[model samples]
Target chain A: MSNQELDVLRSKVDEMNGQLLQLINERAELVQEIGRIKEKQGVNRYDPVRERSMLNNLLEKNDGPFERSTVEHIFKEIFKAGLELQEDDHRKALLV
Target chain B: MSNQELDVLRSKVDEMNGQLLQLINERAELVQEIGRIKEKQGVNRYDPVRERSMLNNLLEKNDGPFERSTVEHIFKEIFKAGLELQEDDHRKALLV
Candidate 1:
């Protein structure tokens, strides 16, 4: 009984993982597009104000089993990686 | 021309961020459900084999503006965070 329940939950987790992978990649592409636009406009890619506004928007919308701080931390990591993507040099992946 | 283009792309990025936030939280909820089931069954919550398989599945599906390595790295961080959420003693939010 419980075994079947566990299997169902595990499969759902797998489905969620697939969805997350797709969404995060899609977000990355959008970030890259923005980076290209910024480059054309001679603007800095890392706009802390814009980043802060975006983070606030996310935090506002986050209704989570995960805590607010955890969500913020993960998004900041995602945001940092996106910024790193924008740079021409130093595109090393975070291996931790 | 470029300024207007930038606005459009930035808004799209914001939209993506919102969607990603929802999906990630949803995933976390599913993880918590699985954790509860595992606890009831007296199984170790952190299954490295399962984790490796899940990571490989995501990597296989990764069609990315981010490199495959980068995608893997980000997902690993996410997986680690998920694992942390499952623990009773160490739910300290990753403030990174």
Candidate 2:
């Protein structure tokens, strides 16, 4: 009974992970789109002010099984990943 | 015109960020639930094989401006964060 219960919960986690994958990729595409606009306008792709505000906003919205700190940590990683996505082709080529 | 375009894109990004924030919290809740069930069964909360399998599955789903490594990297950070969410209360309390 216990093993079966674990399997059910684990599958639900798997489903959520897939949903997360879709959302992260969707967010990535938006980040890339923003990067393109910034590039064309000769503006920096990453704006720390924008990042700080977004983080603050997310923290405010957080009501969680996870703490505010945990949410902040994960979102910051996501933000960093998105910013890094906008780097120059040469750098990306080197990394890949 | 360029500034206006940026505003639109930035707003979209903000909306997406909000959505991501909600989804991350939801996923965290599921993780905690799974932790509860595992505890009841006297099973360890973290299963690295399951983690690796999820990573492989995410990599397969990757079709992107972000490289495979980048997806893997971001997902690994997320996975680590989720796993930490299941850690002992003493460790979490100390961190908090």
Candidate 3:
């Protein structure tokens, strides 16, 4: 491949990576908000029922080239990460 | 600091990071096992009650330079990550 073509491809990859990082960070922020809400309500941060419902809903809605299970698996991690971010913030607050 | 001192410090940090990575991977494997069990039992991946109990237990046992809340938060993320690993495996199985 030409140097210019390679550079363009690298830039595209970088752009996608940047977007993914932004989304992950955004999700983390949302999780923090959820944690605060749970703390205020005296609710647990880990909600199995809610998680199951989400998975089921996603399964129902999925029309995927990817498997239903694959989608669920990916989303579950995303959800869990978000939950962790919230939990971390709550813990830090409690520590102070 | 001497060059030797810096090298030793860097090595120590690398060793610690490696240990942490191993533990995290080990935890992920355990989570995959738990996921299989849950799938067999028709149980949900996220168990808020179990998670809360764990946090409370950690809090009770903590006599930390770190706060109880900090421990809880860190462990909560660890637990959540493990759960996600399992869920991912289960979902992949379902898709296949």
Q: TM-score of chain A for candidate 2?
A: 0.90
Q: Candidate 3 has which clashing residue pairs, if any? A: none
Model 1 lDDT per residue over B1-96, tens place: 988888898898899888888878788777877887877677898999998998888888888777778877878878787887888423332221
Give residue A34's lDDT in candidate 1 (0 to 100): 83
TM-score of 1: 0.87
- Against the native complex, each candidate's DockQ, computed on alpha carbons, is 0.68, 0.68, 0.02
Residue B8 CA error for candidate 2 (Å)? 1.4
Error of 1 at A77 (Å): 1.4
Q: By DockQ, is 1 or 3 better?
A: 1
lDDT of 2 by residue, B1-96 (tens): 878887887788888778877877787777777776776677887888999998888788878766788778877877777778878542654576
Q: Which stretches of candidate 2 lie over 4 Å from their true place?
A: A89-96, B89-96
Evaluated on CA atoms against the true complex, candidate 2 attains a DockQ of: 0.68
Q: Pick by lDDT: which candidate is best?
A: 1
Colliding residue pairs in candidate 2: none
Using all chains and alpha carbons, the TM-scores for the candidates as numbered come to: 0.87, 0.87, 0.45
From the highest DockQ down, the ranking of the candidates is 2, 1, 3
Evaluated against the true structure, the overall lDDT of model 3 is 0.55
lDDT scores in order:
0.80, 0.78, 0.55
TM-score for candidate 3 (chain B): 0.77
Sort candidate 3 into its docking category: incorrect
